[model samples]
Target: MHLDVIIGVSKNNKSGACDVNDIEKLGSDPKVVELFKLKKDEVIFDDDSDIFITSGSTGKPKYAVHTHFSVINGVKGMFYYLEGMPNKENRRIILGLNTAHISGEGSGVLSPLVASMTSVFAPPVYNIKQIVQTIQNERCTDVLFLITYLYDMLNFKDIGEYDVTSLDICLTGGSNIPPKLAKDFEEKFACKILIAYASTEMMVPSISSPWDPLEARCSGVRILPNAEIQLVDDDGKCVPLGSNGEIWCRCCSNFQRYMGNDEQTKAAKSPHGWFKTGDLGVFNAAGVLSIVGRKKDMIDRGGIKIFPADIENVLSQHPSIEQVQVIGVPDERLSEEICICLRTKKNAIIEKDQIVSHLTGKVRLEESVPGYVLIFDSFPKSITGKIDRMSLTKQAIDRIQSKVQ
Candidate 1:
C-alpha cells in the first residue's frame, strides 16, 4: 500500500533528484536527510497507506491514517459533484494550497491524479503576483485557493494587471468568506466561485455549484451526493431546519481514525459512524448549509449566545478594516463579553465608536455588538493560517487586566 505510488513521490520529494524507486532512500537525500534524522519514526509508514497530519488549530496535532480505499472514495466524491467528467480539454488546475494538509493533498494532488488532470502547483510562498502569473501562463480551467489567500489576492494592488480570463471555476473554503468579498471576487474575476465546506475527518461533504443561484452561491454550500448531514443540539438531538447546531456528517470519504489516538477518535465519532465536526451550522430552507462558527468559539454573554462570525461578517465590510476577529473575554458581571480585535487598512484610522455604529446598524441584536475593541497590526494565526482565537482571547484578557492595575 505505498500511498506515494498513488499521488506520486515527485511532489513530496523535496529534492527533484528522487524518483519512485528512491522513495525508501529519501533518508540519503541531502535536502531531507536532516528532517529524516530528527523525525525518522514519524515519517515511516506501512506500504500502501496514507498519513494525514491534522493542522492542530484546536489543540495538539494528530496523525490521521488513510488507506488506498479511503483515498479512492474521497477522490470519487470530488468528481461526483463536478459538473462533468475530467478530460484533457478541461482538466488543467492550479493548486495554491499547502500539500501537507488534506485540502491540499486530496484536492491538489490526489484528485488530479485520479481524474487525470494537469495540476499546476502554486508557488510555496503564495506570492499573489506569482500565483496570477501561473494562472495566466497555464490557462488553468479550475483552481482552489484558501479563503484567506483569496482575500489577499482580491486586495492585491496589481490584480488587474493579470489576464485571468482563462479560469472557469475558482473554489475556496476553510473559513467563512464575507459576502462582499465573495461577490467582489466573482464580479472582478468573471468566474464562478464555489464555496466548499469540508474537514480532515470528512474529506469534502459539500461544495456550492457553479450553476447555483447567486444567493445560494454566496450564502451556503450545497451538500454533495453520497454525503449525509444532520445538525444536532447539545443533547445530540437533531435540530430543526434553519436553526444552528453542531454539524454531524457521514460520508464515504470519512477518514479511518486518528493514528494512535483512540480516545480523541472515539469522542469525535459516534456509533452510527457520524463524525461531529465541532462546527455550528444551519441548513436554510433551500437545503443549503451555512456554517455559523465553531461551537467552542460561541460567546455566552449573560446567557445570550453570540457567534463571532456574525460580528466578523458585518465588521469585515468596514472600508478601513482589513481583517477582524471577534472573541469572548471573561467579565465578572456578564460571565463573558464580546471583544473585537481588528487589523486596519494601511494608514487607516478607526475609532471604537465607529465600529459600534457600524455594528449597531448591521447586527439586529444589541448583545451581538462588541463591547470591547482592540486594534492590532495583525492577528496571530496558527500553523494552518486560520485566526488563532485562543491566542487573541488571551491577549484581550491581558490588556483588560493591565488597565485595571
Candidate 2:
C-alpha cells in the first residue's frame, strides 16, 4: 500500500530483489530522497502492472498506469478492427515511435510482445533514410507514425527511391493528419492510411479502419467496440449529434489518474468517470469521430473564436508549404491575432503576400486569415516530436515587441 512497498516489488526494478525495509531506507537517504519525493503521488504501480510515460506535449510529463487486462483489451481491440485487412499474415511491423510515449509503448512494445510479432525499431534519432531502408530490407507490412514523422516521410526528397511496396497498413496518431497528406500517401504508396485517435489516458479508443469508406477513412475514426465517447459543451451538457464539442472518453483501457497530480486528475475526470480529453471533436451522422482542435488551443480573435487547426489545414495545402503551425499572438485591439509560423519545402520560395493571397482565395472568413505570417527554417518540437506551440508563441511575442520598440 505504501510507496516503498510498491517500489520494492515492482517487476521493472532491475536493481536485484529488495524488501519494503530496504526500499524505505533508500527512500529515506538524503541523497536520493529528494528525487523520490519530488512528486507527492509518484508511487510505483503493482509488480505486474504496465507503465507508460506520457510525451508531455502540453506540459510536464507523467506516468500512465495500466494493468495487464487493460493492455490486453487495447491490443485485442486493435486486432479485432484490423482482422480483415490485407497482409494480416505479414506480422513485420515498423515502430518508428519513441517507446517512452504511449503510441510507441502500445504498438512497439506491448502489442507486438503479446501477439509475438516482429517489430523493427528505428534508430534513436530516427533518420528518414535509415527508416526507409529498414522498411525495404525488413519488408515491413505495418507501420505506425506520429503525425510529425508522417509529414517528414511524405516530404522526404528521396522517398520514391526506396522500395516501400511491402507496406500494407499505415497508421498515424499523436496529432491530426492533413486530409491531403493522407490521401497523397495512400495514392503514392498504394496502401491504406488509418488516422487513429487515442490518448495516453485512454489507449487506442478509436481508429479509422480499412473497412471504412474512402472519404471517411481519410477524415475521421470509427470508435472501437467497448469504448464510449461523449461530446459535451462548456457547461458539460452533451452536444447534439454532428456538432462540435469537447471529447470525453471512457473505456476499459483508460488510465487511473495523472500519476502525481491530484488536482489535474480531479479536473480531467467527471463524476461518471468520463475523462475530459480537452480536444474538441464532432461525430458524423454515421457516428464516426473527427477531431477539430484542442479547447486550450483555440484563439479568441476579438469576440470570435478561431480554431488554429482550420487555418493550419488550409495553409498545409499550399504547394510551397512543408509544415505549418497556427498560434495566437496578443493584440491590443482584437485581444488575440492569428499568427502562422510555417516551414517551406527545400528550394521553395514563399512570400508573405503570396500566403495572404492564398488564404484570401481559400479561407472564407476574413477574420480567419492570419494577421501575421512568419517563415521558419524549422519549428520547435517537444520531447514527443510535436510542434511546440508554447515556444513559438513566446518567440512571436518577442518579435512583435521588438518591432514596436
Candidate 3:
C-alpha cells in the first residue's frame, strides 16, 4: 500500500520531510514517486485511496480508505472547533502520540499541517516529565492526550514547578474519561479538558465545545458539524433520545471502506452509510453524547451485564488509584467475573478489602464490585497508547490460574 511506503519513508526521514534527492538515495520506487506526485500536484485522492491501517486495538488490523473530500472536510471540522478557542493565528500544540494511528495522524500531524500551526512532538515513548518540559520550553498553546496521560500527569508531583500558563485548551478521549481526573487536571494545570468522540473509521464526530461548563467537560461531547449520530439497541432499532445504545455515526469524513475486508465493512456499515462504532453512548437532553463503555467489553456475569466504565469511573476517584482497567474472566458459577487491574499512585498502599469497600456503594450495582483486584506497577498498552485490554485479560487469567495451582 502507498501508506506502507510512506510509513517507511517517515521512519528514515526524522526531519518529517522528504525530497527527490532523499527518495533517490532510498532507491527509486514507483509507489514513492506516486506518493510525492500526489503531494506536489495537490490533487484530491479518490474514494478508493487506501490511506491508514487501524491500530487493531479491537481485533485484527484493517486498512481504511480516505478520499481527499473526507480529509479536507474533517480538517474543516477541526477549524470549526478551533473557532471557539483564543489565539486563532498563533496556535502551538504538543503531539505525544503514535502517528500510525488515526488519532495521532489526524490531531498530531494533519490538524497542525492544515491549520498551519507549530507542533512540538513528544518523545516516541510517552514521558510526563518530557511532555511537561516541552510545553514549558515551547510555550505550547494546546495539547491532546489519552486519558492515561492525564493520570500520569496528575501523579507527577513536580508539575507545579512548570509554567504551562500558555496552555489555553486541551483534549482527551479514546475511552471513558473519568470526570474526577479531568477536574483534577484542570485544577492543577489550569487548562480545560475537552472530551472528544472519534474513531479511526469516523474522523471526528463530536467534541465538547471550549465554552462548555467545567462540570460538563468530561461528561459528554457536542456533536460536530456535518455529522449525524444515532443510538441503537442490539436489535438494530434506534433507541429513544437520552437512552443508552451503540453509537452509529454518519459523516462526510467517515471511511469509505475497510480495505480488502468487505465482510467487516458490511458488518460495521449500514446500506445508508452509518458506521456502528461498537461504543455505547447516551444522549443528554441538551444533545451532548456521553460514551459509557465499549459494547463488546461488557462483562456478563450470571446474565447480569456490567459496563467496565461504570466501575472504572468510581475506582479512579480513589486518591490512591492512578489507573485502572476492568475486564471479565471466566467463572464457573458466574459465567464471567469482574477483574480490576489497577496501577496505584506513588507510595500509595491499597488492600483488596479497601477496594471492595470503596466500590460497595459507589458502583451502579452490587455485582459491579470487582471479584478480583490485581495491583500492578503498570498496565500493558497497545501501540496506540491505550490500555491493551486483550493482553491484560490474558495476564489477569494467568495470574488467577497460577494462584489456583
Candidate 4:
C-alpha cells in the first residue's frame, strides 16, 4: 500500500526497497498496509506472536503460525542438520519467485539474512536457458528448486550445457516429483537433487540432503529439532516406527490461526498441540520418514494401499517421459486401480507397456505402478504451479463413469 508523494529526497544509498506506500499504488488498500505495520511491530515484540508462512497458493490460504522462538527453533534444526551433513559450509546462491509464499519467503528470501548470504534476486521464468545464463553470469553456486520449474529446466538440454559444473546441489519440494526427473537431474548435472517436503504450515520440515543415504532420501525424512512428528492410525493410536500412518507435526513454528477462518483453524489443529498434515507416511529402516502419499489420495486397490507417488517416481525416469502424475481410478475388480496422467517430450502416442517396461528395471511391477497410462496436453495447475491432481482425477473419473453408464 504505497503512497506516491515523496516531497523531500535525502538518501544514503538508493536502495530498491518497496515499502507499504509503494504497494498502495498497486491496489492494496492503505488500511491493509497500516494494519500490517501495526501487526508486524506487535508480533516482532510480543512473546506470543505467531510466525506464519502463507501457502504458495490458496483454496483458502492458511497463515501458518509460528512464534519467534519457533522460527529460531526450526532454523536451528535446519542448520544443525546441515552442519552434520558433509561439506555443509558452502555459501549458497538463491533464486526464488517473490510471492510471499512460505517457500519463496522463508527459504528463498529470508534465509540469506537469517541463515547465510543467499543469492537474492528475481529468478528466470522457468526458462532453462535464461536460468543457466543467470547462474553462469552470476556464479551463484546453488539453488532451491520448485518441481515444476526443475522439470522444465531438465527438458532444455542434456545437462552438459552452461557451466553446470559449478552447481553443487538443487533442493526441490512442495509436492512429489517424478523419480525419473530426479534421476535425470542427478545424471545430467552430476549433482544430487534433494527432495524437500513442507507446507504453508511448516516451512522446512523434511529435507533429504545430498549427504544422506539413498534410502533415507525416498522417505519424508526425520522431523527437524523442536518439531514433533508422529504417525497415527485412523483410530488415533500411535503406530510403530515402520508403519504407514497419517502424519502429524507439532512444534513452536505452528501457525497461530487461519487469517479469517476459525473452523479450519480448529480442524487443522488439535487440542493437544499437533496439526494433522493430511499426508500419509512411514519411517524406513534407518528412521527416515517416507511420505507414502496424501491420505485422501491413497488408491484402494482391492484393499491394498496404492500410493501414486511411488509409481510416478518410477515412470518419470523413462527416456521418453517428461513429467507424470499417478492417480487412483475406480474399477470393479480392485475397487480402485491406478491411472497415470503424463505429459511427455518423447512421443505423441504413448504406450503403457513402455512405461511399465521402463519402470520394471527400477521396481517390481506389482508393488506400485499403474495398469494404465493416460496422456494429456497439460495439467490444470495450482497457484504455486504444481499440478492440480485432484481436479484431474475428478475429470478422469467422470469420463470413465460416463462410458460405463
- How well does candidate 2 match the true structure in TM-score terms? 0.85
Per-model root-mean-square deviation over C-alphas: 6.2, 7.4, 3.9, 6.3
Clash count in backbone of candidate 1: 3
Q: In candidate 4, which residue ranges exceed 4 Å CA deviation?
A: 1-69, 81-90, 97-99, 124-126, 157-161, 330-335, 353-372, 398-405
Q: Which model, 1 or 3, shows the larger lDDT?
A: 3
lDDT of 3 by residue, 183-212 (tens): 888887788888888888988878887777
Question: Candidate 2: misplaced stretches above 4 Å?
Answer: 1-48, 113-116
Q: Where is model 2 poorest over a 10-residue stretch in terms of lDDT?
A: 1-10
Q: Pick the candidate with the highest lDDT.
A: 3
Question: Evaluated with TM-score, which candidate comes out highest?
Answer: 3
lDDT of 1 by residue, 1-405 (tens): 224333244455554344666566775788798776677666433323667877666777778777666667777777665526445446678988888888888887877776667789888765778988999999987888877777777788987888889887788888888877777778888877888888877888888877776567867888878689999999899998878999999987787888778999999999999999999999988898989989988889988888888888888889998888888898898898988888898899999888888888578575445778889976766676666677778888899889889
How should the candidates be ordered by TM-score, best one leading?
Answer: 3, 1, 2, 4
lDDT of 4: 0.67
In terms of lDDT, the poorest run of 10 residues in model 1 is 1-10
- lDDT of each candidate versus the true structure: 0.80, 0.79, 0.82, 0.67
Across 1-405, the per-residue lDDT of candidate 2 in tens digits comes to: 134423344345556546656766786689787765685465443223666777666777777777766676777667665555555556788988887677787767777665666788877677888988899999998888877877777778898888999888888887777777777788888878887888878888998867776678767888989699999999999999988999999887777776667888889889888989999999989898989888888899888888887777778888999888888898999998988888898899988778787777566575446788787888787787877777878888888788789
- Residue 350 displacement in candidate 1 (angstroms): 1.1
Task: For each candidate, give its TM-score against the true structure.
Answer: 0.86, 0.85, 0.89, 0.79
Task: Tell me the deviation in Å of residue 175 in model 2.
Answer: 1.1
Model 3 lDDT-worst window of ten? 1-10
The true-versus-predicted C-alpha distance at residue 94 of model 2, in Å, is 0.5
